[model samples]
Target chain A: MKPEELKYAKSHEWIKLGDEAVVGVSDYAQHEMGDVVFVELPKVGQKAEKEKQCAVVESVKSAFDILSPVSGTITAVNEAVAADPALLNQSPLDEGWLFKIKPENPADAETLLTWEQYQVFIKQA
Target chain B: MAEHELRRTVLNETERKAGGKMVDFHGWELPMEFTGIVKEHEAVRKSAGIFDVSHMGQVFVTGPDAFNLLQHLNANDLKKATPGKGVYSHLINEKGGLVDDIIAFCLSMDRYLVVVNAATADKDFAWIKKHSEHMSVTVENKSDEYSILAVQGPNVPLMMETFAPEALPLPRFGIVEKDIHGRHCFISRTGYTGEDGFEITCPNDIAVQLWNEMLELGKPYNIIPCGLGARDTLRLEAGYLLYGQDVDDDHSTYEANYGWVVCLDKGDFIGRNILAEQKANGVKRKLTGIVLSERGIPRQGCRIFHEGKEVGTFNSATYSPTLKKGIGMGYVTPPLKPGTLVEVEIRGRRVKGEVVRTPFHKGGAFSKVLYTGKDK
Candidate 1:
C-alpha cells in the first residue's frame, strides 16, 4: 500500500506521526535493496539526530544504513522485522516499520518529503 | 574510480527482457539477478538456469610451442590437458602470489584456450603476451569476438540434449566443437557452480538467437535466467575460488587451498621456486570455510574472531541457498581445524560460526559424481 498519510525522507525513509512517529525505509528503497537478510535496530531510549545513521539493513549483495528521519529518542523497535529482515522487502510500509521515535520537535516531521514530493524525488533519481 | 565506460554484453537486451536487475560489474552492465537471487539460485540447484558470461575473457594460444609456453606460465601440468580436455590451474607471479586462476583447454597439439576473469582479462592477456614474446606461440584475446552462456544445473544434461544434441557425451573437463543454432560453438563440460553443465561459447552475432532458443527449449525443464548474484552463491556453496575475491595477487596456491592444482614435480614454471618452498615449509595462513550457526549473514571483509580475538577476515561470503546457511572462506593464521568455533563480525556484532569441511552442501551434480563417486 502506498501510504500517502506518511511523509518520506530524501534518503528513502518514511515517517508517520501519531503518539510517536513510526520510522521505516521507503518501498522504493526496500525494492532496490533486494532480499533483506538482517536489520540492526537501535536500542530503546537511544537518541537519534535527524539525518544520522540509527540502524542498519543488510542484504545478500551489500549493507545499507537506515538514516534517522527525525531528531528523536527511539521508544520502540519492532523485533519481528529484526528477527526476519525479509519483512522489510515484503511489507515496507506496515509490518516492516523499524522503530518508533518520540520526536525532539514534533513539527520537524513536516520538514520531510510529502508523498507527492517523494514520488517526484524518486522519479528524478 | 576506474575511467573505462560500462560495456554491455550481447545478451543485454535479452536479460533486461527477462526481468534482470542490472548492475555494474567490472565496467560491464550485467544482471545481478533476474527474478531474485534466492529464486534464481534455487532454480539452478533444483532444476536449470542460464547465465550470460559474455564478460569473461578468452585468450587463444596457437603454435607448435603453445604447450611449452603454457607449461612455463601455468602452475599445473599443461600436458594433462591433452586435446579435448581442460585443466584448472593458477597463473602465478614470480613472488608466488596468484596472477589469475584459469581453465586452459588443450584444443589441439598446437592450440590452447585460456578462459580468465573479466576484471583481469586485459592484465592476463598482457602478462601472457609478454611471456610469449620469445616462444613460438601467438596469443590472441578473443573476448569481444565471442559470447559465453553457461547452462548449469542438475537437469543441465537433459536440457542440453533438447537444445543442442551434438554437445552431449562431453564428460567433465571435456570440450567439443559443435554447431549450436547453426552457429559453430565450443561446448565445454565445465562450470563454476559444481554442477554437471556446459559453457557454450559462440560468435557474438549468434549469441542472442542461441540464448533465446535455449531458454525456449528449456521451458519444460523449468529453466530460468539467472544472474551474477546466484552465480556467486552457487560457486561459494561448491567451494570454488573466485579471482580477486577468494584468492588474489597476495596469496599463493597453497595458502588458497589449491595445492592439488599446483604440480611441484612439473619441472619449472612461474612461482615454482616460491611455491616449492611454501609447500615444504607450509603456509603461515590457510584458506578455510566458515559456516554461520545463527541468523547473521557473513559478508566479504567481515573481520573473523575466535574467542573475542580477531583471527582473520572473510575473503568471500554468502548465504548458501543449497545449505540454507551462511557460508564463506577466509584466510586465517594458524588455520582453524574443521568444527572449530569462530565468530564473524558483521556490523560490529560477532555472529557465531564454525569452521567446516568445504563444499558445505555436497549435493551438487559435479561434487556428487567427482568427489563422492555417487552418480546423480
Candidate 2:
C-alpha cells in the first residue's frame, strides 16, 4: 500500500507537508527506474514552479525529469540524498525527499493526489 | 501512473535467450543489463563476453569509384586501409557536424563496409546517399542484411579457439574469414570496449546460433553476455568517446580528440582543411575527462564551473564500477588541465570535481599488460 502522508503528481513527484511541503519522487517512479544511482536536486532558496522540471534522477541507463510537486521557494535540501543515492531505491517515498518548500499558494496541495486517490490513479497507468 | 513497460533499443540473441532488462536508447530498444552489469563487466575484464551490436547500423559502399567517393565523405584516409582491414572514420556534414562515427572495412578494391551509430542510422544513410549524387558509388543500407556480435576481453582467444585456433597469431587489428558452429562468417579483431576482441558478422538467420555457440565455449572462462549499459560504462572508463555523447556535428575531429582519424597528410577530405587549421591553431571547446571529488554524479549537459564561473558542460557520465567513483567526459574551455579543479552543478549544488587525464581506469580486461603469464 502507498503511504498516507504523501501526495503525488502525475509527473511522479511526491510531497509531504508539516510546516513546509517536502518533495521527492514517488514509489512508482523509483520502481520503474530500477536502481537510482544519482539524484540531482535543486538547491535551497531556489524557486520552483508547479508542473515544472525541478531536478533530474539518473538510473542505470537514462535520466528522467523530476517535476515540482508545488510552486514554492525551496527552504531545505536533503544533502544525504546526494551522497548515498540508493536511498531512493530503498525508500523513494520517504527518506528520498528532495527539498522542503514554502508554498506560494498553500491551496496548491489540494490539487495533488491524495494517498488512496493516487493509488487508484496510478493503478490505471 | 502508466503500465510498467520494458523499453528495447535492439533485440540481440542474449535478451531472447531468457529474461533481460532492456532500455530505450536514442529511440531504439536495447538491452541494459544481462547476468548483472557488475558480474558481466568483471567477466569481460577477467575472461570474455559477447555483446549484441546488431542494433548499430551497417552500410555497403560498392562500385568502381567507391574509394574516390569515400575519400571525400569520411575523415579517415581510405587509401591507407588495406583490403580486409578496418579503420575507424567519421562521416561529417558540410558544416563539419559529425553525421556519424563509423568503422569502415575495405573488403576489396571496389567494396567497403561501414558501421554506424544506431540512433543516426536513417539520417546517416540519407546524408551519405544525398551527397553521393556527384559520385558513381552505390550506397546500400545493409543493416537488415546482417548482424554483429563482439567477443571481447582477456580470454577471447581461448574462447574462440574452437573456431580458429590459429586466430591467436592474428594481430590486434586483424580480420579473417572463419567458421563458427559450422557457419561461415567474417571476423574482425576490433572492438569499442577497449578490449582485445573479435567482431563477428554473419547473416541474420545464423546470428542466434553463433551467439549461443560462443556462450557455450566461453563457459570455462566465465564469459558473460553484456548489454549496452555496462558497455557504456566500460568505454567511458577506457577514456574513449561515444559518437552522440562526447561528439556530434557541432564539434570537430580535433576538438573531440579524434584528430588521429583526420589523416591531414592524405591530401584533403571534406573536413581536412578545417581540421588542419584547427590542429595548427587549436580547437575552441576541448573534450576532457572529469573526476567527481565530492559525492555526486555529473551527468550529461551539467554545467562545469570554475570558481563559480561556468566553463563548459558534461557530455555523459556514470558511477564507474571500476573506479568506485563518479567519472565523466565533457567539453571545456581553456585553463582546465588534467588535474584542474572544477565544480559540476548537480541539481543546484556545486559539487567539487577535478579534471583528469583521460581514461579514469586502465583497461584491465582488454590490454595484454593486464594479463599474466599466458597469451592474456
DockQ of each: 0.61, 0.27
**What is the C-alpha lDDT profile of model 1 across B281-332, one tens digit per residue?**
9998999999999877788898989988888999999877777667889999
RMSD of each: 2.8, 5.6
Per-residue lDDT, model 1, residue B197, is 77
Across B48-78, the per-residue lDDT of candidate 2 in tens digits comes to 8888888778888898888887888888888
TM-score of 2: 0.76
Query: Considering every candidate listed, which one attains the maximal lDDT?
Result: 1
lDDT of 1 at B312: 94
Interface RMSD of each: 1.2, 2.5
What candidate 2 gets wrong by more than 4 Å, as runs, is: A1-32, A35-59, A62-125, B1-17, B130-136, B179-184, B364-376
- Top candidate (TM-score): 1
CAPRI-style quality class for the chain A–B interface of candidate 1: medium
